[model samples]
Target: MTPEGKALLNIVILGFGFMFMFTAFQTCGNIEQTVIKSLNNFTASGYTSMSIIYGVFSASNLVAPSVVAVVGPQLSMFFGGLLYSAYIGMFIQPRVWSFYTASVLVGFGAAVLWTAQGNVLAINSTGTTIGRNSGIFWALLQFSLFFGNLYIYLAWHGHDHISEKDRQTVFISLTVISLIGCFLFFLIRKPDTSEPIPSETAEGLQAESTESISGSGTPRRSLCTQALDAFVKACKLSVTKEMLLLGLPIAYTGLELTFYSGVYGTCIGAMTRFGHDAKGLIGISGILIGVGEILGGGLFGILNRCSHLGRNPVVLLGLLIHYLAYYLIFLNIAPDAPQAPEEGTDLQAYITPNVGVALFCSFLLGLGDSCFNTQLLSIVGFLFKEDSAPAFAVFKFIQSIMAAVAFSYSNVLQLPWQLLLLVVTGFLGTMSFFVAEWKVEARRRDSAYDSI
Candidate 1:
């Protein structure tokens, strides 16, 4: 490819990457809201039903890593995209069982997309550039959430009063967009096949060497020796302590996902309690959050270009911002403040302070969160070999599990405790830096020994 052509290809791929991440998250957001709205419209008891749907969807996170490992990231992406498209269609004619089945498909597919995209970026980008690219990817996703909420708001505007035909029309439009997104997967060039492989003769020789080594011992002794050898190899390569450190920030990311997913509902509920018009407030808040994310992503990308400013500090700052955002949300939902509004007024005085707080928090959270996310990826890339997909997949699996637990816990706990969970997350986010530092020191020591 010419220089211009390669640059254009990169841009196109980046745009598609953004869209894929955006759609994955946006579709997940839409499903939850759509189910609740449909249930309310049908005058059916939906709390329990919706809870079950979310649980099944959340559980699918646990299996996504395994799927990626078995099928390869490219096929996994295709499967996820198709499954997401199908779920969108199923959502149009939702039933209790339909919602449940669809959630499972969507959740599983999302996991696949998440894993595949991370691997694709890692394979294609170098060092800090990976961080910049990841920031762009995440920014698009945040933008999607910002607008997706607006789409839901407009679709069900005066949802309490909309006709069934109007609702159906809105759902059909969303379904169409989702299907188009799935088709776009075809545009992603297959992952690079440039890495050289061992020839057949080399492989055969290696197999014979392995067999001769095994033949030197009796069967039982060989089995025992093999187990010991495998254990030692695992111990040498595996960074168990480092992995644990990484898990902390990942768990926090999971908490953030849970909070953000339910933020609209929380905002609406809080506004209603304060006698405000929640619909308008939510619409405005969503746009502000989207704008904030774009700014945040851009800022992070710029910082990544600087050698001195690195990933650790950026992540630390992001965690702090994320913590504050949730704290503000908790305050917005406090019970003692006010009453529901009188019937005729479109203006809601109760939401002014809440919206102001949320907007500021959203901007900070977006800036910090996206920065941290990019930094995390960079750290992982630095710490592991090129073929780190399995490790990445495992990390993501842990994140999904944490998110599932947090989401379920939110149903029973207050906002304050949920926000507290983020505090723990921030502390954990620092672990990657420490681990990276330790690994550097260890390598230095090993080099010193070899020199001696």
Candidate 2:
């Protein structure tokens, strides 16, 4: 096969593999807080474990690029997949120690998995193809949400309460599904690194390819030194003007991601009065969220390939949709709905909470998320082509920190206040993104003029 054909194949394999892995991972994550909360009303183990996962994920991002450099993207991804499988397996027979330990390990796994994913996509794409590749991958990856939740909806739809036996059965099945994904990762053919990727600086490419050569044709820097250099390079890149400007939007993605993935589902689960099938609402929420994400991913991923509309407009549209979702959520869900459902006590909501509205809000949230992430990946791939791995590591680092902070407060903060925070952050993040886009365009024009 040609290099282009091979690149597309690798992209598909990565996306397909993640679809299987995250089907188990994300489904379990959506319900972790709720299920654990049900098991032990006295402890905040669920939210706390998630918080730890992101916290460790944030810290591990510092070295994720370094690890990718040493092991290469393929092995890095395979190793990360192994860790993800271990985390999912813990759900079958969860212990407090095992749960928290797995959380920490999975955090490290996420860092490498995402960093390696970015590296592979960047290596496989040029400026022209990054958007399409990102879109295709994202569209495929979101299918996990659909398949995973469809099972939940079917298994627990009519049942009011989930039995331990049912939970074990579901988790056992998911664990096996995740293992299949691991095997797929093992099958990804390594991309040819010899081809010159447009926009990558010679120096950056050389540095990434090796540490240094010796007079006797031996390596100069130790493997550990090379890894340290990668970490340092990532830190240096994180402080650049472009990356700094992009940080606001990147951080907002993390915050908004936590809201929909963790907090919003929790709120849905908490609403006992929504119907007799309150537990089932969580499954419905996941499925619709997946639908919304798939639509956005397909539109931006495929349609943009034809139009080349750039990233800014998609981000602006996402901002508007998010605003709409937040407003509806504020009106429909009570301020303290995420905390718990109270019986016989009147909840303070602007409108009576309708099940349809709550689920619709989830869809919007998912759609908006795809808009932000797909564009973010495209933009970063274009802007930092030479240093793709570090740039992606920095993006994940900031995003994970925001997610961790949001999760820490998810249980304590009221829904209204949380929505208010999102509104303010969204406005600022969108504006920051525009500034970054303008700067990049101006620089490109100047470079062209210089060539003339």
Output the number of the lDDT-best candidate: 2
Candidate 2 stretches with Cα past 4 Å from truth are: 1-11, 40-44, 68-75, 118-136, 190-221, 301-310, 341-348, 448-452
lDDT of each: 0.52, 0.79
> In model 1, which runs have C-alpha deviations exceeding 4 angstroms?
1-14, 17-21, 24-38, 41-78, 115-143, 153-166, 188-239, 273-277, 307-310, 335-353, 428-452
Task: In angstroms, give how far residue 238 of model 2 lies from its true place.
Answer: 2.5
| CA shift of 406, model 1, Å | 1.2
Q: Could you tell me the lDDT of residue 140 within candidate 2? A: 83
lDDT of 2 by residue, 308-388 (tens): 556789999999999999999998887776777323114748887799999999999999998898888778877898787
Best model per TM-score: 2
TM per prediction? 0.70, 0.87
For candidate 1, the TM-score is 0.70
Worst 10 residues of 1 by lDDT: 199-208
